[model samples]
Each structure stands twice: as structure tokens, then as C-alpha cells.
Target: MSNITNQSLSEILESINSKKISSLELTQAYIKNIENAKKLNAFVTTTFDQALENAKKFDNKPNNDQLLSGIPLAVKDLFCTENVKTTAGSNILNNFVPSYESTVTKNLWNNGAFLLGKLNCDEFAMGSSNETSFFGNVINPVGDHLVPGGSSGGSSSALAADLTPATIGTDTGGSIRQPASFTGTVGLKPTYGLCSRWGIVAFASSLDQAGPMTKTVNDCSIMLEAMSGFDEKDSTSINKKKESYSKNLKDNIKGLKIGIPKEYRVDNMPKEIDELWEKGKKILKDLGAQLIDISLPHTKYALPTYYIVAPAEASSNLARYDGVRYGYRSQKGKDLIEMYENTRSEGFGDEVKRRILIGTYVLSSGYYDAYYLKAQKVRQLIKKDFDDSFTKVDAILTPSTPSSAFKIGEKTNDPVSMYLNDIFTVPVNLAGLPALSLPAGLDKQGYPLGLQLIGKALDEQKILNIGYAFEKNCGYKNEIKKWWS
Candidate 1:
């Protein structure tokens, strides 16, 4: 039997179909990887026993060509799993297990994908690094104790460290892409409403869309095929007819209209990231793609706007965490108000508290119109920037981050530095566009950096195709990430 550790999902499934391997054996391989790579802290909770039992069922049953059938996947803890403790990397939900499964999870399970575990994440999907989790920091596994970008940090770390072949992550402001850049993997945040947000815990309702994170673009394409589509439960979910992402996987990039966002090359961007961007453009040009200059002039306002809008919405959405309901409750409080305050104070991590404070402040009565309303107008302007840019370019490209992953504690004391991690990705969320981050090159510290492709709204497939094509051209596939070992 082939060792499942190094095998792709498609390869594993093909082996399973031919009786060369059993689902039990395949699941065991990943379970073993999880045990061996314990230092990375990729998962919040595991379900090996449940997975083994399911694999046993698959062994006795029929085999089919389901895309993810028998393939092991770790979901970000943000998604609700029936009866699983989905902490969402927060102590607030430490003992809170959802009685109902999320729509995205149901879709994966229904498609025959195997669940190895629920991975760790930033608290409420708020932070850029996984350090905010109550579960502790997710070590880069790539080398130094660098940050694994978040709130999908565990998802990308799992894939990069070979703990899982693929996993799903939600991106509000580069949660998927930034992590992918940090870990050197392929992560896609589908266009707004392309993937059903139903059942996935919401951070910013309009901005959050779940997508796949995988080691390769092909793996990304395979997983994405199952991750998307419409759901009635989520009113924002688009009812698009599903298409085969693999069909466009091999599309030629010749004459492809790749746009370079002139505004994203902010003066503050590190020179190394600029070099990586240059390399990406050269690779595309070498592949016969014509690079066009595009402008998203409102890009400068994305950070401030996202901070105001997301927090205002989050402050309102997170109000459900009151002590009376689920999550941690304060047993010592004499009154309801005290209970709420005490519980929240103790349950949430520092970052989560900071965001909640910011959110609350923005949404507070006197501040709403000044911060929230103005942010809304800026949000529209950011969206308009993309709308205007698309008229000149087929797809826009930019460095996924200002720089590569930073040391674990380097940015912790400086909240501004931590927030800057999402600088490049924030605009996409503000506009609710599809953006994919793929490993491009390495930085001076030898950490992997990434290049991003922002496609038209509801046009996730094109972004993937562009990433797949560029990945082939750049040929840096595992070079930057392989240093982790």
C-alpha cells in the first residue's frame, strides 16, 4: 500500500477505488501525522475514533468518484460541527457544542469527505495571527516561532505541515489568504455569497465567506468544487449553479489579463515583498500574460473602514454571548449585569476583548454615524475601486502581505503591527470580492511569502484558474514552505 502521508487526495481516492488502500488506512495516515506534528497546534479538537468508525463503514460499502470521498480534511474551528466543541479558538465557547451542524460542514460530509478534526483559529476570527486562541499559539512549523496568519491559521498550518491534505477556512479580511501566505499554501476566499455562510460562525456577516486551504492549487480546485453553492439558510448565499473547477484548472495563461494594482505598492511595503511581487509579475509575463496597470485608489481607506464596519457588526452580532445563553458563565456574580461583564472579561482573550471594545465603541449611540456611517461610505468607495479597476484588468494582483510571517511575540505588544497583517487583504473583504493567495517566493528570513489575485465579484473560478496557471509558471510550489521541516 502506498504511504498516504505524501499522497494527494485524488491519489488516495484512486488507490481506495482500486482496493489498493482502504479508507481506514488513509484516515490512519492523517491521524498519525496529527500525532507526529503535535508541536504545530493545528487542531483544537480531533475525532479519530469517529473517523475510524466511518472509514470502517466505507470499507464495507460501495466506492464512487466523489471528489472528496475518503479524503481527510480538518475544518477550522469556526464552523459548527454537530456535537463537537467548536471553540472558535475562544474560551467563551469552550464547552459550547453545537447541537446542529453548519451548512458548509453538512455539504462536505454529504460529499463523503472525512473529518479528521476541527482546527484552531483566532478568537471570533478576529486576529491576523493564531496567537489569539485560548488553545495557545500555532507554531509556524516552517522554522522559527513565526506567526501562522489567522483566523484560519490552523487550517493553513495543517495543510502546510502535512497534518491534513486540505481544510476549509473563512476569510473576512484575509483570514484564509494571509494564513496561506504565512504557511506557504493555496488558500482562497470565494467571492461574497459564493459559498454558503450558513452554520459557519459569523464574524462580519457581509464579509465572511468560507473557502478551501490546501497544499496545491489542484487540491484547492478539488476542495472548492464541494465547498461552494447556494443554501437557503443563509440569505446572503448565492444560488449559483455549481461548475467543475477542474475543467478550468488547466487553462492556458497566454494573453491572460493580469492586473497590477498600482495603489497596493504602498510606500510602507517592505522591499522584500516588493521583490516577490516583481517575481510574480515576471513569472506571469514569462507565461505570456499581459500585465496591465490598475488603480484601486480607495485602497488606502480599507483598513480604517473595515475596522469600523466589521466591529460595529461584530459588536452587535456578538451580543449573543451574554452569560444567560451558551459559553462560559460566571458562577460568582450576584446580578445579571455583573454576570455578563464578569463572564465576558474572563472568557475572552485580550485580542477578542480589544475587538469587542472597538466594535462596541464604534456602534455606541453617539459614535455610530461618525464612525460606522462614514466607514460604510468608505466601504462603498473601496468596492467601487475594484469595480472601476475590473474595467481595465481581468484580474488584479498584489502582495498578500506587507511582509512574510513575523516572530510570534514580535507584534503582540503592538496592536497596530498585528492589525497591519491584514492590510493587503482588508480591501477585498470590504468589497466582498474573491481573492486567492498562492505561494510565490520566500523573504529574507527564509519564510514563505505569497501573491494574491482578486477576481471580479462572484468570480472565484477565475481567481483559482489564474492562481493555478501562475503557480505552474512560478515553479516555487513547495520551495518556500519546504523549509518548515
Candidate 2:
């Protein structure tokens, strides 16, 4: 309770229920934190006054009775927030405020969750480094001049900087986990179709999933409870009975099997990360969980598979913004096609345009079978790697990122190198599995590296149960990441 700025959703709910803090006061505190931490560049737009008004309605609602009641959170700019400027960190939608709210955001609000503002992110959720954002790059709160990763970098940075207790982010290919790894916070990418995709600005429909970024596992569970559900508006939204994400929190992992894919230890991992991975293995082993050396042969092909599949889907999803719709439109043009080229050329960032071109090229008539179809087959093989491994193990354990937070401009110039950062994470997306990034240990530079745990599809609660059990037994304090020093 030192600053209350970084209070978790559960903490806020408990405090509100006890009358130690009111919902309106919590809203004000979060807004003040956002305003004070402007240097973090975590938020693109804030709706403080609007949020304060909403909190008034929750003044007397019992916290235990109302899900997420009195809890304040932020939305990634990629989500359409009604009446709030939903710029996806791109000039393309700079002036576009949505007339409708995204299903995920609306779901959170419907659960009595208070919205703080719109967090910054990569333009169109297209890049690994938030530097692609038109608004500006987000600085890592834990390390000076080090980027907070992307395309959910803003949400992670905001949580790390204590700007917001919880936030929503989309992951197509490790966007959520990589940033969470960089920022030293808990990030969960639940099973695809768990969270509705309606009104979420499309990156890749097949891989796009909305999840929570929080200070701890429990907070993430609470946020997930509020954000996930079935929605007819989103055809992909699974019509499954939603269970309490926190239900399995106290479950013990005494006999659970953890898989270590030797293939995930890439050819050039930093020594510190390798050591950290070994240390993590020892900790889990000592805690009574058995570790097995599982081989995922297709691990090396994850990046190539993700690149083709993500962009191919991206091309189709992004075609809606043809300057004839809601995004930017060129004022002077000879014809419609020229107008689209000029407007899009001026609107999208280098990384986004590059992906679009790559996506379009791979999915084109001549190369569709050679590129897109082949990538799909590779994707199936990657999925099989997990499926086959599950026969031997319950969950897969690996490094969330090959390295910790790199310097701001380090990999921005090389998209291929940047994409490889998701080597250990992409297959999870390709297979539509549930994944989580937990704080592991600090690296050589004092930056934090997180442990990744991926569970079978729709088994997110089990992963949470494992993380919860580990936290209980690992003797891990909620220490601030080393970069803070």
C-alpha cells in the first residue's frame, strides 16, 4: 500500500469493499498516475473525466457481488473504445474515434470494470518494437531507453510503470508475451476465441486474441474473468461455458509434468538466459514437478511459419482500410486506386506496410500454394509438435524471449531479427494454445527474463493453477525487476 499506484485489481476491489478507497478515488488515482507518468509514453489517450463519471455509479456496489467492480484498467489503442480516440498508434486512424466499443472492452465495462484510457501500441499491432507507433515509442519503465516490446508494448509498459493496474492487449504472434517478458509483468494469451474479437482492430483474425496484462497472476485471473465470454457478434468467439479463471488458483501442481524442449534453446542464446533457464528448471524440479526433455523438432521453423501465416491473415484483415472506409484518405488523387496507394503509403508505418506487402505477396495467385499453403502445413506440423509433446508432458516450458529487453533502437532496423524474438512464442499462437509469461530472474544487464508456460487450448486455468502453485512454493517475493535499479 506504499503508493497504491500499482495496486492489483483484487487489491483495489478489497480496498473498495472495505471502504478504504472509493471507486471514484481509485479512478482519480489511476488518472493521476497516467498524467504523472507521461514520460513512459504508455498511454496515447486518456478518458479521466469520463471514467470518473462512470465510477460514481459503482460507489455503492458491493465489490464481491459485482465482478471487477471498482477496478480500474486501460485499453490497448487497437481496441475500439466508444467516444474515446482509438488510434492504433498510427496516423491512419489519428482522428478516428469509434462509434462502437470493442466486444472485449464492452465486456470489461459490463462487468463493472472502470476504463482509465487508451494505451499506446504498435501501429495496427504489426511490429515487435513499439517504435513503429506513429504516436511515439514507449520507453521501458524498468530500463532507460530500452523498448518495452510490442505490439502490446504500451499495455505492458503502463502496468510496469504503475500507470494502470490492468489492461487489455491482443496477441497474434507473441505480442502479449514478449512485452510482458520485457516489462517483467504477468501476461496471458488465452485460447483463441476465448475473448471476443468484435471491434478489436484486426491484425490477423486467425491468431488475434485479447488477454490481460497485470502485476500478478491473480489480478490477471480477475481481469480475464471480466474480459472473456461468448459473443455472437464475433463469429469466432467460442460458445463455451465460461468458468471462473480464479477457480483453480489454489490447486497444487505436485504431480504435474513440465516439458523442456531442447530445441527451444536456440543456437545463439545469451549465456545468462541459458543459465536462468537451468535455474528455473531446478526450481520447478525441487518443487516436486518432474521435468522431461521433450523434443519439438519444428521449433526452428516457428518463426518462418508465423511470418507467413500472420502476414497472410493480416493482408486480408487490413484490406478493409482501403481509404474508402474509416481510416485515412488522401485528399488529392487522380483515381481510387492511386488514392488508396497514396493514402496508405502516407498513413501506415514502415513495419506495417512491409508486413502488408509480405502478406499480399505470399497470398498472391502465383505464390499462394508455395507460400501460404506451405506455411499452413508447417503450422500444422508445429501444432503437432505440441500435440505430440502433450502425450509426454502436460505443459511446455521455455524462454519467453531469447533475450531480455534490448536497447530501444537495437533490432528496429532488422525486422527479421526482431521477429525471431518470438521464436519460442509463435508456435503457441499458431496452435492457438494458452500461454503465460511469469517473472523468472534477472539477466546479465540486470533486466528481467520471464518464464513461459503454455497449456493446451482452453486449458488456461490449468496454466494459471501451475503458476499460482509455483508462486506459493518458489518463495518468490513480488520484487521489482532489476532494471529499476
Candidate 3:
């Protein structure tokens, strides 16, 4: 493997800016790594030719002023790229191509980053593990048989494996943070509306937020700065002044208050995770931050509320892929009504169909008040829990996941068990807050464990700063051997 593949996104960009390495050299190195990492199944589509062309274009007329100058970033398949085959890791959209680019990717490109490829993800971003991806499960680079967490598993896996210098993923209830925890990488779920949803494949409209998955917190800040901004095209986008997250990043968190939520200590959580949490608290304390024991009373309701609210939005969002549009069609059906039924039945994977059914059920006439409406009420309570907590603290510290990465099929047979993996992460999404998962330590089995730093809405800068400081002191380095090749 080329040594260029080992450099962080910041390091590589610095080399590019100093003219020590051309953009073409950087892109080619990543392409070689991706080619050798096919066993990981991280990429659903590879656009090497276009990437090469773009790199050459950058080398010819380099723009050093751009934040992501000449960078090649692989993104979750959920983000639609102009004229690219964006499947969202589902057979339904296997042939779907978008004429326009997603606002997030457009932002990256505008800032001088070009597409390396589209990454595999859970079918319509539905499952907790990448096993539900129609393309194939993305294997964690940390271990051979371990499943990469999802629905942003491919983004996490590819990044951990160095298939891409940096990547982006959509978090709809722990998708980004859980996968990063599993892969021993950095992943951020930014505040809802911080990144636009326009042109991304929707799993759940209300909860889906695009954020960076990278090798380090600094790279995360750089990517986040480049990708986030207000988009008039997306009604949910926050129209705020563009913040310089990278420039503002500082390790001097002298008097900041970090909440150690008591509710995060769930029953049966592994001792290592608890130890990791303690380790994080100590790091913050040593860095001169105050740690407080806080209560998010509505934390337990987050999972059920997310399950109801997400699927309800999913069922409504996924209604467009009925074969009459630009995706997979069922030739088996003879008539229009039969076509819609057969198309959805044949097109969507098991997980996607399951969510669609669950969503449809909850949103149905008689059950709306009983399920969906009640979930919305509970969702507010969950948000209120965070809102109340933030009044007492600037940030919250918790374990990113209840456990480390599991074997590919360990939880596949039991969907409920798989869903439980996101227990520590789902609350952030339910509250629509920003959270960053940083690899803090290793478990007894040598798998990576993570600690989460969550901030108030649009307070991503604070958590990123805290994370940068924790990262400096944690002494956690991912020593993943390249066994995949």
C-alpha cells in the first residue's frame, strides 16, 4: 500500500497545497486502496475515471483557497450525485440516476472535493447493521468477520480501511455514530437542519442529517465546514451564518460543563463501555472541564419513539419508488395495481419492507392517534429532556454504543437485538442534537469502543472542541492491521 493512503485528510491536503503531491497522486493512491479492499464491500459504485478527470483538472488549475481542495470523498449512497447511479444500497433504486446533485455533495464539490464513489448502506438506510444492504454487508476493517454498523456502514468501513481519505454519511437514528464506533473511526451527526436534505434518498425525513465520517476529529471539522450551509432548496435547512468550525476548533475547554447522564448506564451494558465512559470523564476533567451527573428522564422512551416516528416518515418518503418512476420495475405484474404491489414486494429488501409495513401500520387511519401521534408527543418529551439537560451543561458524555462490533450474522436473526445496538445513540437523533463519536479505547476482544460527546443544537463547535481535546489525551489509536487485502 502507498504511504499516501496512511495520511490523514488534513495531512494529504497540506501536501497537495504545498505542491508536494498532486491531486492525481492522492486520488490514485485511494483508488488503489479501494481496489485492494474489495473484500470489505464498502463501495457500491466506484467512479475512478471521473475522479481521475477531476483530479487532473484540479492539478491543472488548483484552487488552494477551497476548504476541501482537490479532495476525493466517497459518500453514502443515499446522497444523489448528478448523473451517477445512486442505489441507496437497495435493489429498488438499483438503476436510479439523478440529474441533479444533493445539496450536501454539491457543497463539497463547490469547495473542491470530487466524488470518489458511492458507498453501500442499509437498504434505504433502514438497518442497524450493514447486513441489510442489498449490495452486500460492509465488513469492518478492524476485524474480518465483524459487521460494520449501519446504515452508514460502508462510509465507516471505507474510511477505516483508508479506501477514501474521508467520507460522509447520513444519520437517521444512530446510523453514523454507531458505525463509527464499530469501525474505530470518527463520525459526527450534526444538528438537524445543519446539513440540507435536498436530493438525498430519504429514509426518515425528520431525522436524516448528513455529517462527516473521517479518520480524526480535525478532518471532521474541515469536512463539516465544507459540507454544511443553508440551502433554500431544502425547507428544513437552517439558514444561519456559515461557521468556521475548523478555524474555531480549540482544545482549551477550561470551564465548560459536560453532563454525564445517569440514564446512559443501561442494564447489561458491558463493563468495558462503562470503563470507557469513566475514562472519557477523566479526560474531560483533566482538561479542566466540569462533569455533572444529569438526568435525561425521557431517555428510555427514545428507542420506541424513534421506531415509530422514523418508519412513519419512511413509509411516506418511500412511496415514490413504485416502478412507475425511474427505478426497478416488476415485469411479473400484468396491471397497474398489481404492478405497484409486485414492484415494491420484489424491489425492497426485507428490512426496508419491514419498516414500510411498520410505518404504514402506524400511520393508518385507526392507529394514527394510538401510535404515530403518540410517538410524536413522546418525541417532544425526548427533545425536552435534552433541552432541560443543556440548561445545566454545555455538553453530554456517554458511550457511543452498548457494545463493540459484532460478527456479521450475530444479531441478524434477532432484529430487536440489532436495534438495541443503537440504545446509547438514538436519543441524540430523537432530540435532533449534534453528537460526535470518538474511538476512546479497545475492548477485551481487541475491538474498538467509542465515547460520544453530544452538544446543544448548532453547538457542534463546542463538542468538536471537547472531542479534539479528548482525542489529544485519550491515547486511543486505531492499530488496525490490513488483513482485508
**lDDT (tens digit, per residue) of candidate 3 on 338-452:** 9999999999988888889999999998999999999999989888989999999999999999999999889988888989988888989888899999999999999998999
Q: Clashing residue pairs in candidate 3, if any?
A: none
Clash count per candidate:
1, 0, 0
Q: Estimate each model's TM-score.
A: 0.97, 0.96, 0.99
TM-score of 2: 0.96
* Shift of residue 299 alpha carbon in model 2, Å: 0.9
Task: Name the better of 1 and 3 by TM-score.
Answer: 3
- Give the Cα lDDT of each candidate: 0.84, 0.84, 0.93
Please write out the lDDT profile of model 2 over residues 80-157, one tens digit for every residue: 988888888999899898999998888888787868889899999987779899999998887768899999999989
Write model 1 residue lDDT over 241-326, tens digit each, in one string: 89889666775778878889888888778899888999989988887889998788888889989888888788878888886778
Predicted structure with the largest lDDT when compared to the true one: 3
Clashing pairs in 1: 142-484
Q: Which stretches of model 3 miss by more than 4 angstroms?
A: none
